[model samples]
Target chain A: MLRINNLHVKIEGKQILNGLDLTVNAGEVHAIMGPNGSGKSTLSHVLAGREGYEVTDGQVLFNAENLLQLSPEQRAHKGVFLAMQYPVELPGVNNMTFIRESINAIRRARGQDEFNTLEFLQLIREKAAQLQLDEKLLKRNVNAGFSGGEKKRNEVLQMAMLEPQLAILDETDSGLDIDALRVIAQGVNSLRSAERSIILVTHYQRLLEYIQPDFVHVLVNGRIVRSGDKQLALTLEQKGYNWIIEEDAA
Target chain B: MKSPVQNAQLQTPQQRQQLQREWFQQLVVGAEVDAEYDPDWLLPLREKALQSISTLPLLNRKQEAWRYNRVDNIFQNSFDPLFDNDLEQKICIEDIGLPAIDSYRLVFINGRIDLSLSELSELPAGVILTGTAEALRTIPDQLMSSFDHLHQPGEQLFTALNTALFNDGVYLHVNQSVTLDRPVEIIYLNNNLTRSEQHVGSMIQTRNIIDLESGASATVIEHFISNNKHEKYFHNNFTDINLADDSRLRHYRIQDESRLAYHLSNVQITQHRRSRYFSTCLAFGGLWSKSAVRVEFQAQQAECDLLGLYTVGDQQLTDFHLDVQHRVPSCRSSEQFKGILYGRGRAVFDGRILVDRQAQHSDAALTNDNLLLVRDAEVNTKPQLEIYADDVKCSHGTTVGRLDPEQLFYMRSRGIAEHSARKMLCQGFATDIIESFELQQLRDYASEKIAHTLNSVESEMEHKNGH
Candidate 1:
C-alpha cells in the first residue's frame, strides 16, 4: 500500500533521515520502534507532506502514485493520514465545522457526494461514542485545552471519521494512560479490514500488547536496521535500543 | 454649516496672541481659574466657552437635549493636560507593529512629533503633510476656519475642551488638481508610564484637519495606539475633513489602545459637489471608547461610504454614534457597522440618517449588526432613518445576535484544516469590512489581529470556566 525508498530528509540543513527504506502491503500492520531523535516522527511527517522539511534525496509512492509531488491536502485526499504527535490547537474554529469542511473537501476532490447534515451528525456521534469521548468535547475547539488522554482519543476519533486507507499513528501511546491506550487500540482494531493498512509508530513496546502487529521494524539513524515478526518487539523491550545501536556501530 | 467668525492677516504667533487678547478683553469674561499653562490664542476661546456656559439657563428634566446628560458628564474630569513628556528618543516604525509601507509616515509619542521617526520631508509638491503646530504657525486662519461648523461650547463641552487644549495632531492639505501618490500614516502612541504609578491620569487632546481642493485626491490613515499595557490616560481626538468639488478622500482609522485608557473621538466630514468619501473605522481597544462620526453631503452627485468594526471584551465598553445628512439632491450614502461582544462586554450603536426635502433622488442605507459571544455580554443597537424627501430611497436595519448555539454544539469535525478554519471564523463577520480596506497589508494585518484576539478571548473564557 505504501513504499519509501532511499528517503534522506534534512531539516534546516541538518540531516535527519538517511537512506531509509520501508514497504507495507494491503491489510498489513507494521510496528516501527525507535528511540528519541531516531527519525521515527520524521518519516510520518515526510509522508504527510508537512512543510519546512527538505527531502534532499527520496521517493515516496502511495498506491503506485508519486506522493512527494502532492500538497498536504492532496495527500489527505489520496487516503494518507497522519495522527499527529501533538494535535494543533485551533481556536475560534468550531471543531465540527472544521471536520465537516475537511471531509467535504476531500470528498469533492475524490468526486464523491458530500455527506448530508443529519447523516454526518449521526455518523460522528456514533464514532465518537465508540472512542469514549464525551459529546461535550466534540463541541469545544479542536485540541484546544484537551487533556493528553483526550487528545489521543480525539486523534483516534478523527481517524475513524476520515477512514483513510493507510493510517500512521505517530507516538499515539507517548502520553496516554493504560485505559486510553486500550480504548485507542480497540478503535484501531475495529477499523482494520482486508483493504486497510496501519503503521503503529512508537518508542515503547507497551502498545503492542493491546493490538498485535504482523511486522516489527527497528528504525535507527533513519533506516530500518532490523525487521522481524511481533516477537521482535518483545525482544527489543527486553534489550533496549542501546544494544541495537552498538550492534549497528559494530 | 459655516461659521461667521472670519478673520485673517494674523501672520505671526505674537500677532495672533495680541488679537486674541483684544477679543478676550472685549468679551468681559470674569470666571477665570488658573490659566498659566494655557496658550495665548486658546485662552480667549476657553473664556468664551465659560461665558457661553454661564449665560445658559438652568437644567430641567423637560429639556430634550438635557434629558439624560448630567452636568458632570460634560464639565467634570480629574485628568491633567499638563503632563508634558518631551521624549526625544526616536523609535523605529516597526516597533509599533505597523508595517513600514512606502508612504508618508508621522509618529507622535506623548503628543510630541518625532522627526527622526517621521518620513514627511520628501512629500510631493502641492501636498502638505505637517503637524498641527506648524500648521497653526503657517495657516492659523485656515486651520481655525475648518472648525467653524462645529457645535458651540454650551452644546458640546468636550469639543470645546478640545479646542481649548489640543496639543498636537496631523494637518494634511492637497492643492487643487493634485493627487497624492501614497497614503499618509499618522500614528499616535500615548504611553505616559511614568505617571501611572502616581494615580495621575494625563489627558491627551489631538485635533486633525484634512482639506482636499477641487479635483484633488488623497488617502489618510489615523492610527491610535497605547504602548504600556496598563497605561492610564484619557485621549480625546477630533478630526475634520473637507472635500471640494470633484475631490476624493479615503480615511481609515484604527484605535487599539491600552484597556485601561478612556478614549473619545469625533470625525466630521463634509463632501462638496461630485466628491466621494470613504471611511473605515476599527475600534478594538480602550477600556471605555466612544466615537461620534458625522458625514454631510452638501451638493449633488456626492457619495459617501462608512464602515466600522468594533470588538469589546471583559469590562470594556464601546459606543458609536453615526450621523449622516443628505442635504442636496441626487446624493448617495451607505453605512455598515458591526460589533463583537464577549465576556461581559457592553456595546452601544446609535446610527441615524436624515434626508431633507430638497434631497430628492437620494439613496441611503444603514445597517448595524452585533454578535454577542457570551450570555453576560450586552449590545444595544438602533438604526434610525428619518426621510423627508418623497423621491428618496432610505432603509435601515440592525441586529443583535449571538453565535449559533446549534452550530457550535457540533464542533467535532473531521480532521481539521487550521488555516481554513481561522479564515472561516474571521470571514463570518469581519470579512465584509476588512475586505473593503483598499490596502492589502492593512487588511491582512487586521485579519491576523482579529484572529489573535479571538484566541485570547477563548483562552480567557476557558480559564474562567476552569475556575
Candidate 2:
C-alpha cells in the first residue's frame, strides 16, 4: 500500500534520514525498531508532510500517487494518518467539535455526505467507548489539561475515528504503562483488515506482544538494515541494538 | 476669536495663558446654559465642575494615563456642546441594533432623552426610571444623594467636561430589598451631527446614575451607537453606580460608534460591604476610542469582576484603562481584558489593582492578553499591581502574541483548510472572553458581532491581495 525509495531528509543542514527505503503491502503490519536518534520519528514526520523538514532526495508513493507533492491536509484527505508522538494541546477548541469538523472535512474531500450532529454524536460515542474515553472529555477543550494516558487514548480514538488506509504509529507505545499499552494495542488491532495497513514505530518489543506484526525492520542511521519476522524483535530485545550495529559495520 | 497672526503676536507665555482662558470661558458658557433650567441643588455642583475644568488642562501624552494614546489628535478638531434643541428626528430603537427585551428601556438622541422611543411603563414598585432632570424634579432627595458622590469632577478632564456640559441622561433607582426581574437597557444613539450646517463636529456629553439600595439587585446595559458613518462627532459619557451593602449589579457597555467618531467613556463604581459588581465591555467601532473604568471598594468583603473584549482593524485605535481599588479588609477584584488587532489597528490596555494599607486579606488579580493578526497591527499592555498591605495577595500578567503555529498545524492536519483553521482559532480566542456574559441573548449578540467583524476583515484582506 505504501513505498519509499532512497528517502533523503534533512533539517537545518543536518542529515537525519539518509537513504532510507521501506515498503508495506495491503493488510500487513510493519514494526520499525530503532535506538535513540535513529531517525524513526523523523521518517514518520516526513511521510506526514510536516513543515521544516526538507526532502533532499526521495520518492514516496501511496496507492500509486506521489505523496510528497501533497500538503499535510491533502495527505490526510488521501487516507494518510500520523499519530504524533507528542500530541499538541489546543486551548479553547472543543475536542468533539474539532473531531467532527475534521471528519466532515475528510468526507467532503472524498465526495461523501457529512454527518450531522446527531449522527456524529452516535458515531463518536461508539468510537470513544472502544477506547474507554469518557464522554465528558470530548466536551472539554482539546487536550488542554489531559493526563498522559488520556492523551494517548485520545490519539487512539482519533485513529479509530479517521479509519485511514495507512496509519503510522510513532512511539505510541512510549510513556504508556502495561495496562494502557494493552488497551491501545487492542484499539490498533481492531482496525486490522484486508485492505488497511499500519506501521508501528517503537524502541521496545513489548507492544508486538499485543498487536502482532508481519514484518520487523531495524532502522539504524536512518536506513533499515535488518528485516525479519516477529521473532527478530524478540531476539533484539534479548540481545541489544549494539549487536545489530556491529553486524551492519562488519 | 483671535486670528492666528494676532495670536502669534503675543509672547509664548501670554499665548498659553490666553488659550487656557478661552477654554475656560467656553466651558463656563456651556455650564451656565445647562444650569439655567437644572434644579437648585445641581447648580453649585455644576459651578464646582466648571471651576475644576477651568483649572485642569486637557490630557496630553505626557501623563501616564495617556502614554500610548494621542489625545491631541482627538482634540485637533473643534467641538461644540450638544444642546436640548439639537434633537430633531426621532430614532427607532430597533434600527440601531438593540434587541427586543421585555424590560424597561430608555433611549437618548445625542444627549437628550427621547421620550417617544422610551418604554418605562409597568415598572415594579419602588423602581424609579426617568431622565435625570425628571428625577431631580420628582425624587430630588434620593437622586441628589448619589448623583455626584461616586463620580466627582476634577478626577479626570473628560469627567469634568461631562459633569459641566451634560444635558440629559438616565437616572435609575431601585429600592431596598427589591430584586429586578428584567434588565434595564439604556441606548445612547449619536445622531446629532446629521444637521451638518449647525452641529457638525458636535460633542454629546452624558452622565448616567444608578443606585441599588441594600439587598437590591439588577442588571444594567448601556449601549452606545451612531447613525452617521462619515460625520465626525465626539461622545463623552460618564456612568456612576452605587451598590449598597449586600447588593449586586451586572453592568455591560456596548460601544459601536461611527468610523469617524471619537468616543471617551468612564464608569465609576463604589461597592459597599458584601456587595458584588460584575461588568462586561465590548468595543467594536470607532476611529479613536477610550473606555476608562474605575472601581472602588467602599467597605469590607466586596467583590468585583471586570471582563472586556475589543476588536479593531483598518487604522482604528481602541484603548481600555481599568483601575480597581481594594480599600477595606477582605475585598477582592479580578480583571481580564483581551484584544484582537488586524491590519493597522492599534489597541492599548492599562489595568491596575491597588490594595491599600488597611485592605488586609485582599485578593486581586489582573490579566491582559492580545492577538495581532498582521505585522502592522500593534498592541501595548501594562498590568500593574500595587499592594501596600503585607497580608494581601495580588498578581498581574500580560501577553502579546500571534496564533499558535503548532495548533494551526494540528488543525490543518485534520483536513481543515488553513483559512478555516485560522478563523476558528481567532473566534475561539475572542469567544473565551465573550462567554463571561451572564445573559444568553447578549452572549449570542456579541458572538455574532465578533464573527461578523472577523469575516469582514478577512474579506477585505483577500480583496486587497487580489488587487
Candidate 3:
C-alpha cells in the first residue's frame, strides 16, 4: 500500500527524481533496476525519509499518510525500513543491544510491550539462526570490523527483526559473495508476507534469481521507461541496460 | 590541607641570588634531621636536596611540565603544617568501599595513619605498617636511609615541602623474599572538618625488595580519596616505590576530591632488573587536581604499564604530567590517558617519554585522547617523545575532539534522546581506559560515576534552558 504521483525530487538544488510515478500494492515485490545516476537509490532514500533529499515537487503516500513529513525515526516507527547500501559502523554499540533497542523503541512507539533481556536474547537467537548468522557476531560492536558480506547479512537480520510493513532494500547485493548472496536472498524470501511489501533496488540481476521479484521496472534518466513481469529481469540480464537506453532514446 | 610554601617574589637577578641565600639558610634550619635516626649513607642525598631546594626556584608556568598549569596559585600560598588529632578521626571503612586486600589496613585521616582500626596482626614478621613519626623513633636508621632515595626534596615544591614537614605517614616494609599475596590498602581521607589547615604529606616507602626469587608476583593497590566538599583544603602527597630484581608491583590510585579541594601528588617509581611496575590512576573529582609521575627504568627487561582516566565538570581542572624514562636497555613502557571535560571544566595532559642514549631496543608509547562535551570545556594535550637512541620504537599521539556527529545522529535516530546519545558516546570514549581495570566492581562503579556526571551536566543545561 504505497503510492507516489509526479514525484519530482531535488537534492542540493539538482533535479534527481523527475516526474516519476510508481505504486506497489501489499504482498508485491517490485524491482526497480536502473543504470548509474538513474535515481534508483534516490527513490529508496526519499521514501525512507533520509535528510537532505528535498521533495521539490511530489508527495509520497504510505497508508494514506504523507511519508515525507515524518522524521526518519518516526518513519521507522511507522514501519518504513531502509536497508542502506552501506551500513554505518557504530564502534561501541553492541549488535544485539542495538537491534534490541531499535526494535523496542519502535515497539514502544507503536504501543507494544518492550522485550526484556531474556526475551531479547531469545529473539536474536531465533533471527540469527534464520539468517544462518554466527551467534558470535551478535556480541561484537555493531559492524565495527565486519566484512562486506557480514554487513549485508547484519542489515537483513535487522530487517527481519524490525519486520517493517514496507521494506526498501538499496543495492543489497552490491558487495555480497555468491554464498552470502544466497543466504541473504533466502532471509528476505522468508520474511515475505501478504501484509508486507518490499521494493528491491539493484543494478545487478543476480539477486533477482533468488528473491524473484514479481514486477520489474527499467528506470532510465530518473524515469521508469519500461515495466514488465519477472521475465523483464531475464531479458535485461540477457541484453543490458544499453538496449533500454537506446530504446528510450528512440 | 593547608597552603603549600610560597616562593620568593620575582626580583632582579642580584636580588634573587640574595633571596636564594636567605632561603637556603632557612631550608637548612627547616630540614634539621631527626637525631638518632639520620643515616650516614643518606647524608649526601639530604645535602643535595638542601642545595637543590635553595638553588631551584619554585616551578613557574615557563617550565614545560608546568606550561599549562596555574602555578601562580601555588606560589601565592605559604606552607602551613597540619596537626593531626582525633577530631576528624572518624572513618567508616564501609563508606570507603575498597576491595578486600590481604595484609594490614592503614587508614589516614587527613594524612595521619589511624592505627586503632589497622590490622597489623596478620603482617609477616619484620613487616611494619606504622606511622612515620613513630617509625623514625623506633628505626631511624632504616627510615632515613630510604628517604629521598627515589625523590629529591625541593625539586618539586610539594615534594620538597613534604620532606621538610611530613609529621606522620605509612611505613610499609615487606621482609625480603616474602611472597605476600595480599595488597596493603592506604586510604587517605581529606575531610576538611578539622578546623585546622589541611596540608597532607605522606610518603609510602615499599622496600620489600621482593627479590621475587625469579617468578614471584604481587599486586598492591594504594587508594587516595578526598571527599571534602569545602574550601581551605590541600592535598600534597608523594609515593616512592622501589622494586627489587624480578619483583612485580601493581599500584592503583583513586583520587576523587570535592569540587573545592586541591589535589597535588607526586609518584616516583624505580625499577631494578626485570622488575615490572603497573599503574592505574583514576581521578574523577576535584576543583584543581594535578599529578606528576616520574618512572625510571633503571634496569634492563623492565616493563611499565601507565594508565590514567580523569573526568572534570563545572569549572574544575585536572592536570597530569608524566615522564617515562628509559635509562637502561631493552625496557618497555605503554601509556594511555583519556579525559572527558564538561561544563567549563579544563584538563591538561603533558606526557613525555625519554629514551636514553644507550637505551637501545626500547619500546615506548604514549597516547592521550580528550573529549569535550561543551563549548566552554577545554583540553590541552601535549604528547612529547625525546628520543636519543635511534633504534628505539617511540611513538606519541594526542587527539582532542568532540563526539562524532554521525554517531550521535545514529543514536538519536534510534529514539534515544540526544542527551543519552552524548553520554553514551562519552562513556564509549572512556571505556578503553575503564576496561583496563581488572576489578569489575571498580570498573562498574567508575563507569556509573562517569555516566552520571555526564547526564548531570546535560540535565542542568536543560533546566537552565527551561527557566
Candidate 4:
C-alpha cells in the first residue's frame, strides 16, 4: 500500500532523511526503531506531505500515487494520517466538530455523501467506547489543556474515526504510561484490517510488545541499516541501537 | 423630484456642515438657572468646551487616534439636531436576551429621545433616570457636579463638539447602597433617511454625589447599531464613567453599524478608592471604525478590566486604543484585545499600561493577539507598559501570528478540509474572549455570531473567486 525509493529530504537546508527506502503492504504493522535525530519523525512528516521539507531526491508512492505532490490536506483526503509527536492545543475548535468536518471532507473527496450530525454522533459514541475515550472530551476544544496521555488517546480516537488507509503513529508512546500505552495499542489493534496499513514509529521497543509488528526496521543516521521480523525489536530492546552500529561496522 | 439640479446642489460640503449641532447650541442659548438645580458650575465648563472645539480643529489622518479610520467621509454627512417635537415616531421596546429590570430604558432615534417608551417611575425611589434636558430643568443642581467630570470639553474634539451642542440623552443615577439585579439598556439607533451621516452624542451622569455608600453595583449595556447598510453615515459617541468607593460597574458596548458607516467612540472611566470597573467593547461592523478607552485608577485598591474584540474584513479598517493608568497603590489593571483581519482589511491595536510612582504593589498587564487570514491583510500591534513603581508587577505581550500549523494538520488529518479547518481555527482564536463573558446567553450569542461571521467570509471569498 506504500512505497518509498531512496527518499532524501532536507529541512532548513540541512539533510534530515538521506536515501531512506521502505515498503509496506496492506494488513501489515511495521515498526521503525531509531534513536533521537534518526529522521523517524521527518519520514512521517514527508509521507503526510507537510510543507517546508524540500525533497532533494527520490519518490514516495502511496497506492501507486506520488504522495509528495499533494498538499497536507490533500494527502489527508487520500487516507494518509500522521499522529503528531506533540499535539497542538486548539482551544476553541470542538473535538467533535473537527472530527465530523474531517470525516465529511475525506468522504466528500472520495465521492461519498457526508454524515449528518446525528449519524456522526452515533459513530463518535461507538469510536469513543472502543478507544476508552471520555465522550465529554469530544465536546471540549481539541486537546486544549489535555494531559499527555489524553492527547495520545485522542489521536488514536481520530485514527479510529477517520479510518485512514495508512496510519503513521509518530512517537505515540513517548509520554504514555503503561496503562495509556496498552489503551493506545488496543485502539490501534482494534483498527487492524486487511485493507489498511500501520506504521508504528517509536524510540523504545515496549510499544512493539503490545502492537506486535509483523516487520521491524532499524533507522540509523537517516538510513535503514537493518530489517527483520519481530525478534529484531527484542534484540534492539535488549542491546539498543549501538549493537546495530557495531554490526554495521563489522 | 422635479428639480434634480437643486437636490444635487443641496448635498454640498457647506450644507453638510450646517447640520452639525443644532439642538446642542440651543440648550446653551436658552440657559436658565433653576433655583432647584443650578447651572453655575457647568457655565464656565461649557464655555471652555466650546473654545476647545473651535481651536483644536477636526480629526485628521495625521493624528494617531484616527489612524486607519477616515474622519473626512464622516464630516461630509449633513445632520439635523432639531428635536422632532411631534413625538410621531414609533417606539419599539423588545427584550432580546439581556436581563430586564425595573430600570427605565430611554430609546433614541435619529438623535431624538422617545420619552413615551420610558418607565422612569418604576425605578427605585431614590434612583434618578431621566433625559439630560429634563434633569436640567428639575435636578440641575445634582447634574452640575458630575456632568463634565471625566469628559473634559476640549480634550477630545468630538466630545467638545457634542458638549457645545448637547441635547436629549439619558441621565441615570443609582442611589448609594443600591444593588440592581438587571442592567440598564440604552438603545441608540441611527435611522438615517437621507444619504447624509447620522451623528449622535449621548451622556450618562450620576446625581447627588453620594459615593456609593459602600457596596453599590450597577450594570449598563449601551448598544449603538444602524439598520441601513448601504448609507454613508457616521456615529461619534463619548461615555464618561465615575465609580466611587466600594462601587462596581459593568459597562458593555456593542457596535454593529453599517459597513459604509464611520463609527468613532471614546470611553473615559475614573475609579475612586476601592472601586471596581469592568468594561467590554465589541465591534463587529463598519467600513472604518476606531475606539479609544482610557481608564484611570485614581485611588488605592481600585481594579479595572478592559477587554475588546474586533473583526474586520474586505476593505474595512478597525482600530482599538487603550490607555490604563494605575495612579494609586495596590491598584490592579488588565487589558486584552484580540482581532482577526481578513481580505485587505487592516487592524491596529495600541495599548499602554502606566504605573505611576507610589503605586507600589500594582499589578498591571496588557495582551494583544491578532490573527491574519489573508496575505494582503495587515495588523499593527503594540502593547506597552511604563512602570515607575519599583515594587510593581507589570508585563505586556503582543502576538501577530497565523494559525498553528500543527493544529491545522491535526484537524486536516481528521478529514476536515483546508477552508473549514481554517475557519474552526479562527473561531477558536477569538473564543477566549467570548467565553470570558459570565452570562451564558451572551457567550452563546457571541459564539454564534462569530461562527456566522467566519462562514460568511468564507462564502464571500468563494463567490468572489467564482468569477
Candidate 5:
C-alpha cells in the first residue's frame, strides 16, 4: 500500500531523511523504531505532504499513485491520513463539527453522499464509545483545552472516522499513559482489515506489545539499517539502538 | 424646502466659509427664536445651539479624535438640511421588513416623525412614547430637566449641528418603577427624493432621548436604514440615555445605510446608583461611518456592557470610539469590539476606560479584535485604560491579525476547500461578537447579514482573481 524509494528530504538546507526506503503491503502493520534525531517523524511529515521540506531526490508512492505530486488536502482525500505527533488546537472550531466536516469532505472527494447531522451524531457516538472517549468532549472546541490523553484519544477517534487506506501514527504513544496506550491500540486493532495498512512510528518498544507488527525496521541517521520480524523489536527493547549502530558500522 | 446646490466655480477657503454662513442663515431665517411651533423655553436653547454651531469650525484631521478620519472631505459636497413636513405620504408597516413584534413602533422619515406610519396605542400607563416635539409640550418639566442634563450641546461638532438643525425625533420616557414588557423600536428611514436637477446631497439630523425613571426598566432598539442605495446623504444622529437608580436598559443600534451615505452617530449614556446598561451596535453599511459612545457611571455599583461588530469592504471606512468612565466605587464595565475589513477597507477602534480617584474596587475590561482579509485592508486599534484609583482591576487588549495559517491548513487538510476554510474562520471571528446580543432575532438577523456580506466579497475577490 505504501513505498518510499531512496527518500532524500532536507529542511532549511539540513538533511533529515537521506537515502531512506520502506515498503508496506495491504493488511500489514510496520513498526519503525529509532532513537532521537533518527528522522522517524521526518518520514511521516514527508508522507503527509507538509510544506517547507525540500525533496531533493527520490519519490513516495501510495497505492501505485505518486504521493508527492498531490497537495496535503489532495493526499488526504485520496485515503492517506496522518495522525499528527502533536494535534493542533483549534480555538473556535467545534470537535464534532471538525470531524464531521473532515468525514464529509473525504466522502465527497470519493463521490460518496454526505452524512446528515443525525447520522453523524450516531456514528460518532458509537466510535467514541469504542475508544471510551467522553461524549461531552465532542461539543467543545477541537482539542482546545484537552488533556494529553484526551488529545491522543481524539486523534484515534478521527482515524476511526476517516478510515483512510494508509494510516501513519507518528509518536501516537509518546504522551499516552499505559491505559491510554491500550485503548489506542484497541482502536487501531478494530480498524484492521485486508485492505488497510498502518505505520507505527515511535521510539519505545512498549506499544509493540499491545499491537504486534509484522515487520520491525531499525532506523538510524536517516537510513534503515536493520529489517526483521517482531523479535527484532524485543531485541532492541533489551539492548537499545547502540548494538544496531555497531552492527551497521561493522 | 428647496435643495441648495454647490457652486461649480472654484472657490477659495473664504468663499467656502461664506457659503456655509449663508446656508446656516437660510436654515434659521424665519425660525430664529419663535419658529411658530417652538416652545418659549426651547427657543432659547435652539438660539444658543445655533450660535454655538455657527462659530464651531468643521473638524480637521489635526484634532486627536478626528485624526484617523477624513472629516473635511465629507463636507466638501454641499448638502441641504432635510426638513420633510409631508405628513400625508402614507407608509405601510409591513413594507419596512423588520421583525413584527408587539411593541410601540415610532417611524421617522427624513428626520421628521411620520405620524401616519407610527403605532403607539398599546403603550402602558405611565410610559410615554411620542415624538420629541410633542413630549416638549405635554411633559415639559421632565423634558426640560433631563434634556440639558443628558445631552451637552456644543461638546462636539456634530452634536451641536444635530441640536441646532434637528426637526424631530423619538422620545421614550419610562416612569418610575414601570417595567416595560416589550421593546420600543425607533426606525429612522432616509428617503431622499431630491431631483437630479437639484444635484444636492440631503443631510438628516435627529436626536432620540430615553429616560428611565428610578427603578424603571426597558429595552430600546434604534434602527437606521435607507430606502435608496444610490441616494447621497449625510445622517447625523444623537441618542441620550439616562438610567436612574436600580433601573436597567438594553439598547441596540443597527446602522444599515446606503453605500453612498455618510453616517455619524453619538450615543451618550449616564448610569446612576445600581443602574445597569447594555449596548450592542452592529454597523454593516455606509461609505464612511463613525459611532462614538460615551458612558459614565455616576453612582456606586453601576454596571455596563458594550459590544459591537462592524464589517466594511470595498473602500469603506468604519470607526468606533468608546469612552467609559467609572466615577464611583464598586462599578464594573466591559467592552468587546470586533471588526472585519475586506478589499481596501480601513477601520479604527479607540476604546478608553477611566477610573476616578474615589472609584475603589472598580473592575473594567476592554478588548478590540480585528481581522483583515486582504493585504491592503488596514485597522488601527487603541485600547487605553486610565485608572486613578489604587484598588482597581483594569485590563485592555487589542489584536490585529490575518486568519491563522495553521488553522486554515488544518481545515483544508480535512478536504475542505481553501475558500470555505477562510469563510468559516471569518464567520467565527465575527459571530463571537454578534452572539453577545440578548435578542435572538437580532442575533440571527445580524449573522445572516454578515454571512451575505462575506459571501459577496469572497465571490467578488475570486472573480477578480479569474478563478
Candidate 6:
C-alpha cells in the first residue's frame, strides 16, 4: 500500500532522512523504533507532505501514485493521515466543527455525497462513543487548553473519524500516561482492518505491547538497519540502540 | 451627468477651500432645510454650519486624523444634494435588503420617510418612534438638545455638512422605566439607482436621534444599504444615542452599501450613571467608507462595548475610528475590531481609550486585529491609550498579520482543501464579533454574508501571491 524508496530529504539545508527505504503491505502494522533524532518524525512529516522539507533525492509512492507531488490536502483526500506529535491548537474553531469539515472534505474529494447536520451528528456520536471521548470536550475549541493525554486521544479520534487508508502516528505514545496510552491503543485497535495500514514511529516498545506490529524495523541514522518480528522491539527496549549503532557501524 | 468638478485637483489650500465652498453652496442651495425638517431654532445652527464649511480645513492626508483615511475621492465626485423626495416611487422592505429584523421598523428611503412603508403602529405607549421630519415638525424643542450635543460643523466638515443639509431619519425615544420588548430598526435605503432619471449621483444626509430616559432599556438596530450594487452616491449619517441614568441600549449597525458608493457615518453615544451601551458595527461595503464611533461615560459605574468586523476586497476601502472616554469612577469600556483586507483593498483602524483623572477603578482596553491577504492589500491599525488615573486598568494592542501558516496547514492536512480551510479560518476570525450580535437571526445573516464574500477572496489572494 505504501513505498518509500531511498527517500533522502532535508530541511533548511540540513539533511534529516538519508537514503531511507521502507514498504508496507495492506493490513500490515510497521513499528519504526529508533533513538531521538533518528528521523522518525521527519519520515512522518515527509509522508504527510508538509512544507519546508526538501526532497533532495528519491520519491514516495502510494498506490502507484507519486505522493510527494500532491498537496497536503490532496494527500489527505488520497487517504494519507499524519497524527502529529503536537496537534496545533485552534482557539476559535470547535473540535466537532473541525472534524465535520475534515470528514466532508475528504468525502467530497472522493466523489461522495456530503453529510447533513443530523446525519453528521449520528456518525460523530457513534465514532466518538467508540473512542470514549468526553462529549463536552468535543464542543470546546480544537485542542485548546487540552491536557497532554487529551491531545493524543483527540488525534486517535480523528484517525477513527477520517478512516484513512494509511495513518502515520508519529510518537503517539510520547508524553502519554499509562492509562491514556491504553485508551489510545484501544481506539487504534478498534480501527485496524485488513485493508488499512499504519506506521507507528515511536521511541519506546511499550506501545507495541498494546497493538502488536507485523514487522519491527530498527531505524538507525535515518535508515532501517534491522527488520524482524515483534521480538526486535523487546530487544531494543531492553538493550537500547548502542548495540544496533555498533552493528550498523561495523 | 457631467462630472461635478472640472478642476478638482486644486493647487493650494486656498484653492481647495474656495472649491469646497462652491460645492457646499450647491448642496445648500438645493437642501431647502428650513422648508422641510428644520425648525426655527435649527436655522442659526445651519447658518453657523454654512460659515464653518468655508473656514474648516478640508481633510487631507496631512492631518493627523485623516492620515490613513483617504477623503480625496470626496472632492473629485459630484453629488446632487437634493433630497430624494420622489416619494411617489413605491418600494418594499425586500426591494432593499437590510435591517434583517422586523420589529417596529422605521424605514427611510432616499433621505426621506416613506410613511406607507414605515410601520410603528404597534409601538407601546411609552415609546415614541417617528421619522426625523415628523419628529422635527411635532417635537422641534425635543430635538434641539440632540443638535446641541452634536459636533458643530466647525469641529468636523462632514458633520457640519450633515447638520446643514440633513433631511430625515429615525427618531426613537423610550420613556423612563419602560423596557421596549421588541427591537427598533432604522433602515436607510439609498435607492436612486432604479430611477434612471437620476443622472447625477445623489447625496443623502441623515440625523438619527435615539434617547432613552432614565431606567429605560431597548435594542436599536441601524442598517445602511443600497439597492443598486453599482452606482455612485454619497450617504452620510449621524446617530446620537443618549442613555439616561441606569438606561441600557443595545445598538447594532450593518452598513452594506453600493460597491461604487462612498459612505461616512458617525455614532455618538453618551451614557449616564450605571448605564450600559453595547454596540456592534459590521461594515464591509462601499468604495470608500469610514465609520466612527465615540462613547463617553458621564457618570459612575457605567460600561460600554464597541465591537466591529469588516472585510474590504477589490477596490474597497473600509475604515473604523473609535474614541472611548472614561470620566467617572468604576466605569469600563472595551473595543475590539477585526478587519480582513484582500486584493487592493485597504483598511484603517484607530482606537483610542481615554481614562481621566477622576475615573479611578476604571477598566478600559482596545484591540484591533487585521488580516492582510494579498501583497497589495493594506492595513493600518493604531490603538492608543491615554490614562491619567492612578488606579485605572488600561491596555491597548493591535495585530496586523496574515493567516498563521501553521494554523492553515493544520486544517489543510486534515483533508480540508486549502480554499475551504482559508475560508473557515477567516470566518472563524469574524465569528467572535458576529456572535456578539444579540440577535440570533442577525448572527446567522452576517455569517452567511461573511462566508459568501470570503469564499473567493482567499483563492484570489493565493493567485495574486503566486506572482
Q: Which candidate is the best by TM-score?
A: 6
lDDT (10s digit) by residue, model 3, range B156-266 = 545554554455666666555665556666777765443444443322212111113333455555666665555345666766667777877777788876666677777
Per-residue lDDT of candidate 4, residues B128-155 (tens digit):
6666667777777866655564343222
lDDT string, candidate 1, B1-467, tens digits: 11112233323534444433433222223212334644456567756655543343433324333332222222222355544566566456688787557789888886667777788877889998888777777777767666664472123645655665576678899999999999999898886444633544567777888999999999888888888777767787888889999999998989898987878888888899999999899999887787888888998999999999999888787888888899899999999999887668788887879899899999999999888777888887877788898998888889887654223322212323433443355445776788788999889878877887888776676687894
RMSD (Å) of each candidate, 1 decimal: 19.2, 3.3, 4.8, 5.7, 3.4, 2.5
lDDT of 5 at B19: 61
Give me the displacement of residue B251 in model 5, in angstroms: 1.7
Better candidate by TM-score, 1 or 3: 3
Which of the two, 3 or 6, has more TM-score? Answer: 6
Count of clashing residue pairs in every prediction? 7, 0, 8, 5, 0, 0
DockQ (Cα-based) for each candidate: 0.08, 0.63, 0.31, 0.61, 0.51, 0.77
Top DockQ hit? 6
Predicted structure 5: lDDT: 0.83
iRMSD for each candidate structure, in the order shown = 8.2, 1.0, 2.6, 1.7, 1.7, 1.0
> Cα miss at B182, model 2 (Å)?
0.5
| Model 6 stretches astray by more than 4 angstroms | B1-18, B87-89, B150-155, B193-199, B458-467
Question: Which candidate order results from sorting by DockQ in descending order?
Answer: 6, 2, 4, 5, 3, 1
The TM-score each candidate achieves on chain A is 0.98, 0.99, 0.98, 0.98, 0.98, 0.98
What TM-score does model 2 achieve against the real structure?
0.93
lDDT by residue (tens digit), candidate 5, B1-467: 43444542465666656665555455555332224665668777766777866677645456657777755456456566656456355566678666666667899887778777888887899899998877776776777654463243323556766667666777889999999988888888877545475546677777778899999999888888887676677788887888999999998899888887888888889899999999889898888999989999999999999999998787788999899999899999999998888768889898989899999999999999988888998888888888899999999999988988777766766677677777878877876677777778888888788778888887987898999
DockQ of 6: 0.77
- By TM-score, rank the candidates, best first: 6, 2, 5, 3, 4, 1
TM-score of each: 0.60, 0.93, 0.85, 0.83, 0.91, 0.95
Model 1 clash count equals 7
